[model samples]
Target: MFTIARFLTTALVAILFLATLPVHAQDAAPAEAVAAAPAPEAEAGELDGLENPNIDAATLTLRLIPLTAEELEKLSADWLAIVRASTVDVVDEQIRINNTSAELVEEAARARLTEVTESRRALFDKYSTILDAWELKGGDAAKIAGYRTYRSAIIVEETRNTDWRTLLAQATSWVVSADGGLRVATNVGIVLASFLGLLLLARLVRRTVRHWAGRIPNFSKLLVGFSALAAYWLTLAIGLMVVLAALGVNITPLFALIGGASFILAFAMQQTLGNLASGLMIMVNRPFDEGDSVDIGGVSGTVRDVSIVSTTVITPDNQIVVVPNSSVWGNVITNSTASETRRVDLMFGVSYKTPIARAQAELEKVVRSHALVLSEPEPVVRVNALTDSGVEFILRPWTKSENYWAVYWDLTREVKDALDRAGMEEVEAGAPPVVAPPTGVAAAS
Candidate 1:
C-alpha cells in the first residue's frame, strides 16, 4: 500500500510538471520572435544617408526657374514648398538668370510699344492735315486699336472742274451758306446722281437687249429673252455688291445670310423648282414644239403655249388643259403629228361561208376610195382570225392626222354597205347573210 501511494504522488507530480512546461515554452517563443524582428526605419535611414549625404541641406537652398511669364504667374506660394520637398535638384544660378531675362524682356516690350505709338501718332497727324484741307463736314473722329481714324460722310459734294464758274455760282447761291454749310446739299446731290445713274443704266440695258432681240430669229426668242434676263440679273448683283462695299458694310456676313436664305427658298419650293427646270429642258430640247398634237400623260391635245411652270394644251374636244411641266417631263410623250400621218385600223367580220378573197378586195376598194386616206401608203386588208362568229378581217390604212376620224368613219361605213349588198344577193340564192349588228349594239352578241 505504501509503495502504491508513493507511485501515485510521483505520477501527479510528473503531470503537473508537463503542463507547466507547455506554458513556459509559449512564453519563450514570443521573446525569441521579438528579438529576431529587424528595425525597418533604421535600415531605411542608413540607406538614405549612404545614397545622398547632403540631400536635406541641398533641398533647403534649392530654387526653381520658370521659363515663361505664364509659368511664373501659375506658380502658387506653396509650389516652392512642394518643390523643396521633392527629390529633383534645382540650381540657384539658373533661377536667377531666368528671372533677369523675363524682367528685361518685359521692359523691352514696353519701350517698343512706346516707339510704335509715337510713329502711329506722327502718321495720324499727316492724315489729319489732308482731312482738314478738304473742308470736310458732318463727320466724326474716333480711336480704334490705338490708332486715330477720321470718319467722313458717305455723301460728298459734286464738283465739275470743267464748269468751275457755274459750279461756284451755284454753290455760293443755293448750296453753300455763310458758314460754308454744304452737307445737306452734298447729300441731296449724291442721292439724285445715284437715282439717275440707275435709271440710265436700266434704260441702256433694255435698249441693248431689244436691239439684239430684233435681230434674232423668232424661233430663238425664248433663248434671247432668257439670256437678257440672266445678264440683267448679273449686272444688278454686281452693282449691289459695289454699293455695299462703298457703304463699308462687311460682305462676308451678307454672303452667309444670302446662302441661308437661298437654301430655305430652294427647299420650300422644291416642286416648283422642278417644274421650272423641266420646262426649261423641254424648251431647250424641243421634245415637242408648239402646234404639234401629242399624247402626254394620258392627255391627248395640241400644245398651245409652254411656260416655265405649266404647259397649255387645246384638246380635240375644244377643252383647254394646263398640265404641270414636271408631269410632262416625267411621263412618256407620243406625238401623233410627229410623222404628219397615222395608221387607222378597222376590223370587220363576214360569214365563214363568205369568200375571204372577195371580202378583202371589197375592203381595199372602200379604203382607197376615201380621199382622206393617204395613197403613198397602200391600204392592207388581211384575214386576222377565223373567229367563232365569223371570219375576221383587219383593214389597215394610213391617213393625215387631221383627217384621222373622218377617214376612219367613211371607210367603215362604205365597207359595211358593200358587204351588205353582196350578202343580200347571196341570201336571195338561199344562203345565210352575215350582217353586223346595229351601230350601238355589241358585235359579239
Candidate 2:
C-alpha cells in the first residue's frame, strides 16, 4: 500500500512536469497538425463514461498552481466527494460480480471496477500534486494540510484492503525488485543494528540506575529494582521510536493509536491500575522491602518480590502467595524487619503461690543470656496479670530484627526449663497454656 501510493504520486508529478514544460520554437508547427487531427471515438460499452463532471472540473482546477487556500480547499472537497463516490461504485461492482452467475457479466463488472479504481487514483494524484505545490508556495493553512494528510491515509488504507491478493502480489514483487530489494535490505539492516544497540544501551541504563539508586538515601530494594527495570524499558521504548523516526517511519499515528487504546483500557483495567498506583506508593513510602517479614491482608510471609501489580510472599511454611498491590497498600502493613531492632513480647503463667520475685529474676536471666538479644534497651520481666488459676508474667526482650524469632523461641524454651529446674510448679490445668505471642506479634510484618 505504501509503495503503490508513492508510485502513483511520483507518476503524477512526472506527468504534470512534462505538461508544464515550455514549447520550443521548432515544436510550434505541431500545434496546427494536432488541431487538424480527428479525436478518437470511445469504444462500445466501455466503462470510462462513468466519470463525473464535478471530478473533471476538480481535476482541471488542479492544473492551476498556487491557488488561494480557500480555492484549494474547495477543490479538495470536490475531489473528496468524487473519491467517496468511486469507492461506492467499486463496492457496487464487486457486489454485481458476486451475485451474478454469468461469466461475461462478472468480467464486465470487474472491468468497471478497474475503471472506477483508476479514476479514484487519478483524483488522489491530481489533488495531492496541487497540495504539494500549494505548500511549497507557502500556502500552509492547517485545513489545506489536513486534506493531503487524510487523502494519503485513505489511499494507504484502501490500497491494503481493496484486494488482498493484489496487495500481496505487489508486495512480493516489490521485495524482489532491484531497487525495492535494496531498500528493504537497508531498512532491515538498520532495524537489526538499532535493536542491538538499543538493547545494550538499555542494559547499561539499568546498571547505571541500580548503581545510582543505592547511593540514594533510604532507597529500598523494591524501589531500586523498580526504578532500574523502569529505566531499562523506557530507554528501549524511546530509543526504538527515535530509530524508527530516523528511518523515515512516521510514529505519530502509532502514538495516536496508543492514546486511544489507553483511554479504553483505563476503564477495563481499573483494578490493575489501582494495583499499579498502590505499588508505586508502597515503593515511594518505603513501608517494606524485599525479604521483609510482612503481614498484609491476613497473609503472613517474607516479601519475596514486589512488582507494579502484585507482591510475591514466601510463607514460613514454604507456601508462595501473590497479593495484589492494592491489597498490600490498602491493609495495615506490618513490616517486622523494617526497624533495626524489634521487641519480642511473651506471656507465661505459673501457680499463684509461686514466688513472683524469683520467677522474674529467672526470666530476666534467661533473656539476657541469649546471644542475639540486644542489651541497650534492657529486657523487662514483671508480673503482668492475676488470672483465675495463676499469675502471668510479661517478658519483653529487644533483639536485632533478623534474630527476633530465634530470640523469642530460645527464651521461651530456656525459661521453661529454668523454671522447672528451680522447682517452679505449673499453673493449674484450667489456666491458659504457654503459647506463642498474639497474632500481632507473630506477623509483626
For all predicted structures, in order, the TM-scores are 0.45, 0.62
Tell me the TM-score of model 1: 0.45
> How does model 1 fare in lDDT?
0.53
Tens digits of lDDT, candidate 2, 1-445 = 8566656644443343233221211112222321112223334433222234344534454444435544444444555566667667766765665566544454345556656655555555555554544445555345454555454445545553444333333344444544344555787799999999999999999999999998998898989999999999999999999997776455766887899999999999999999999999999998888989999988999999999999999999999999999998999988888889999998887887788888888878888888998887988888777767788888888999988888888987898899899898766333654455676666545
- State the TM-score for model 2: 0.62
Best by TM-score: 2
Candidate 1 structure quality by residue, lDDT tens digits, 1-445:
7455544544443332232111110111222221212222322222222123223422321221211222221221122223323311222322332455443534344333333322322232233222222112212111110111111110011121112222223333322332123533454466567656765675578568856875866534445555566566666667666664553233655787799999999999999999999988887776787788899999999988787788889998999999999999999998877677889987787776888788778778888888888887888889776655677778889988888888888886787788888772121211233465799988783
Ten-residue region with minimum lDDT total, candidate 1: 146-155
Clashes of each: 0, 3
Candidate 2: stretches off by over 4 Å: 1-179, 428-445
Error of 2 at 416 (Å): 1.6
Per lDDT, the best of the predicted structures is 2
Which residues of candidate 1, in runs, are more than 4 Å off? Answer: 1-260, 424-445
Location of the lowest summed lDDT over 10 successive residues in candidate 2: 22-31
